[model samples]
Target: MASFKIEGGHKLNGTITPQGAKNEVLQILCAVLLTPEKVIVNNVPDIIDVNKLIFILGELGVKIEKLGSNSYSFQADELKLEYLESENFKKDGSSLRGSIMIVGPLLARFGKGYIPRPGGDKIGRRRLDTHFEGFIRLGAKFRYNKEEHFYGVEADELFGTDMLLDEASVTGTANILMASVLATGTTTIYNAACEPYIQQLCKMLNAMGANITGVGSNLLVINGVDALGGCEHRVLPDMIEIGSWIGVAVMTKSELTIKDVSWDNLGQIPNVFRKLGIQFEKRGDDIYIPEQESYEIQNYIDGSVLTVADAPWPGFTPDLLSIVLVIATQAKGTVLIHQKMFESRLFFVDKLIDMGAKVILCDPHRATVIGHNFQSALKATTMTSPDIRAGISLLIAALSAKGTSTIHNIEQIDRGYENIEARLKSIGAKIERVA
Candidate 1:
């Protein structure tokens, strides 16, 4: 495992640009498997998870070309479908959770898709019932091998059918939407996840000649098309990364500018930071935060403690809760962070506690943070990264701590953030990778 040795208690200043959306690019890259024609994607982030998916695609015989540093063209014209049953395929498919998305396009075009039980962060229980159920509802047959932990779906043909997703799971929605686009008739999906990333997927499909309506809403209607053609698509800037930068600036009392934030798609992120009394300005598409001495949390209109919780799109994102919780530790007041989507995500607060932050872990799903109001600083210590978001959150804490700190298992952070050490260095932050 690699480690990050960080020097804390220093203010950083300069501008930083977030990489392409990791979540969105995963879906878009999978969609490339739907058509035999070449699909060009721009602004692809060079993160571990995404690179793994790209490697998988190349292994599958997708005609891959690197057009530029952050652009690629993919064509699935000569895929090695037999590789799906190979032992090497099982190992590759199970290594990353994003591999599950490949099943949708494979099943849609070739009438079969197989995947081993996907592995990723141990954040909590992320079930695959949503993805398989949607496939079954579309006339596909599902089977599982318990001993081998493998899943397979097949059908002579898939016909359109109306279905309701039990939860607004973003990956589930993307998988089902990709499968539905080539069905025999129209498919209506209720309670679909309408996050901006999902919306980008829908728009990309539409660009590729699929008929999809309700791009930004919970209800999506997909009219089946016989075949899909290739189109060039550019990914939106990552909102999660943008929020992380905001937390870094506030915690270190640094003046920072985050460029090309795609202001309109950053639903509830800026406001959530504002709730912590962190001030920022919208300069064109960039967000500029000046050096800050202190900030105070805002109470609710009813004089109750502000509770920041996660919901579907247009609501606060669950992915950024860790950053918010960390940001609250240095604010002037108390705030409650409720991570309802995943039970174990808030468990990382124990690491923050060890760093001398005043946090009360109310339950598996909630934590109350008592800000130090600039009166104290978190002392540096050795820690391990639990997951992607929590790892970056701990890094933010380490950057603002009183001394040098060490963070192991930094691979979790690399799975999401691209070129993190170099980016931090360019912005005047003291962080180094230890081999």
Candidate 2:
């Protein structure tokens, strides 16, 4: 396993552009399969998970061309559908949760799709029921091979129908949207995930001739199109990475600027950081965070402790809660972090506790953080990364702590963030990758 050795108690300077959104990239890459024409994708993040999905698409016979460092053209005219049932597919598809998205396009275009139970962060139970449930509603037959732990959906024809999703699952919404785009009738999705990423997908589909309305709402209507043609789509800046950088700046007392952040799409990220008293200036689309000695958590209007919780879109994203939780260690006051989406994301706080943060784990879902207010410095210690978000959170903790610290299983971090060590080092961070 690869590890990162960080020399802590240092400040970072200069500007950094956030990588393309990893979550959005995953969904966009899978959306390319809905069309046989060449779809050019720009600003793709050079991260492990995204690269893995690219490799899987190449294996499925998508004609790929590298137009630039972060640009690619994909044409899925002659996909090798049989490969999805092979043993190699089970291994490849299971390694990435994004691979599950491939099933939507395959089932829509080829009448059949198969995937092994996909693997991802061990944060909590992320069930795939919503995906197959939506598929069945559109006339597809779903089957689960319990013996092999595999899933398959097949249909001779798809007819769009009105349905309400059990939950606002992002991937599920994207998958059903892709599938319904080529269906025979109109499809109405209630309670759809309308995150910026999903909105981008809808825009891309509309550009490719699919009639989808409700770009930024809980409801979406898709009028079936005969086929989709080639289109160029550019992913937005990674909001999670932007949040991480903001946390890093506050935690390590650094002055940093995040460039071209696509301000309108950031939702509640900036305000959430501001609620924690983290200061930043919005310069056009960029975010400039000046050096901060310490930040204080803001209480509610009625003098209740500030509670930062994660919900669906327009609420604070759950992905950055880990970073917020870690940075709160040095904040001036107390705050409650409720990671409602995932139960185990808070489990990584034990490592922070070991490094001398005052945190009370209320339960699997809630943690009350009593800030050190920077009076007591966090001592460095070795720790293993539990998941992608937690891994970045720990890296921030290590960078802010005194003394050198070792972080094992940095591969988890690489899956989500592209060349994180190099990026941080460019900003004067003392971090090294060890084999």
lDDT of 2 at 197: 94
Backbone clashes counted, model 1: 0
TM-score of 2: 0.99
Error of 2 at 231 (Å): 0.6
TM-score of each prediction: 0.99, 0.99
In model 1, where do residues sit more than 4 Å from their true spots? none
Please, what are the lDDT tens digits per residue for candidate 1 over residues 1-435?
899999999999999999999999999999999999999999999999999999999999999999999999999999999989999889999999999999999999999999999998888999999999999999999999999899999998999999999999999999999999999999999999999999999999999999999899999999999999999999999999999999999999999999999999998998889989999999999999999999999999998999999999889999999999999999999999999988899998999999999999999999999999979999999999999999999999999999999999999999999999999989888999997
Local distance difference test, each candidate: 0.96, 0.94
Listed per model in order, the count of residue pairs whose N, CA or C atoms clash below 3 Å is 0, 0
User: Which whole-number lDDT from 0 to 100 does residue 244 have in model 1?
Assistant: 96
* Candidate 1 residue pairs that clash: none
Find the candidate with the highest lDDT and give its number.
1
